[model samples]
Target: MRIISGKYAKRNLFTLKSQKTRPTSDKVKESLFNSLGQFFAGGQVLDLYGGSGALGIEAVSRGCDHAVLNDVSRAAVAIIKKNVALTKEADRFDVTNMPAKVALKVLAQKGRKFDLVFLDPPYAKQQMVKDMTAMKQLDLLNDGALVVAETDDQTDLPAIAGFDLLKEHHLGKTLVRFYRKAAE
Candidate 1:
């Protein structure tokens, strides 16, 4: 798949060949960003389940200052690095090869707070709610931070306190859910 919009719009990205990884298509990515926001001014983004770093890189191309991309698979992480390299702005990104939990902890320790987060974990093994909860406890989310979850049609995201459900869009069998953290 490739970036649909932003500075990296039309740029191609690399994805793993394994069936375990499901890369978001250009059409769905377009719909997802359109619903969230066409672009951003300056903010940090987190791609917690980064398969190829496309979402994070797209955020940077759209004006976000920085992005942190993480994945558990080594091959996926390598592909993410390659994709980020294509942007020619690698300094705008931090690539981490680690499990989501470890990545979150490390980012928290570094005092990283994100304005946007993308969660597209495997549909069969989802821990999105738990991940978001940890983000809250670790104080990794900025006030009003936006979290987007891309999942299969069968997956239904439950309501969580302190977050407002902003939008939901269905592109074929893909389900996209948007949420905004409440400010204290």
Candidate 2:
């Protein structure tokens, strides 16, 4: 896969060889970023269920200040690290090898917050609502923070209480939804 825009536009990224991780396609990634304003002025990003670190790295490429990429698989983490190193801005990334929930708790303990978040767990094992709820309880989202969820069309995500569904798009078999956390 490759970065779609910003400083690292068109830069190639490495993905895991295993079927355990699925990298976002270039078309879908480009469209998603375009929907989210293409680039950012400055903001922190969290990439949970990080696969190859493409989503988070793309955020940094598009002007987000920093990104924390987390995945449960060692192979995926290794691939993510390699991809981050390719950016030559490794300092802007924090790679964590852990389950999504565990990583969120650790980040919360550190009082970390994010202006953007990408949640793309395995389609069959998506717990997006539960995860978003954890983020809310941990106060990990900044006011108006954007949460992007990638799932299959068959999986329907309901209107979450603390988040407003801003947009939804269907790309092939993939469904992308953007939610804005209420400014509290």
TM-score of 2: 0.97
* Cα-based TM-score, every candidate: 0.96, 0.97
lDDT for position 57 in model 2: 94
Give the lDDT of residue 49 in candidate 2.
Answer: 90
Please give the lDDT score for candidate 1. Answer: 0.89
User: Cα miss at 143, model 1 (Å)?
Assistant: 1.0
Off by over 4 Å in 2: 123-126
Clashing pairs in 2: none
Q: Write the per-residue lDDT of candidate 2 for residues 1-184, one digit (tens) a residue.
A: 8988888888899989988777899989999999998889999999999989999999999999999999999999999999999899899999999888899999999999999999998853348988999999999999989999999889988778799999899999999999999877
Clashing pairs in 1: none
State which candidate has the highest TM-score: 2
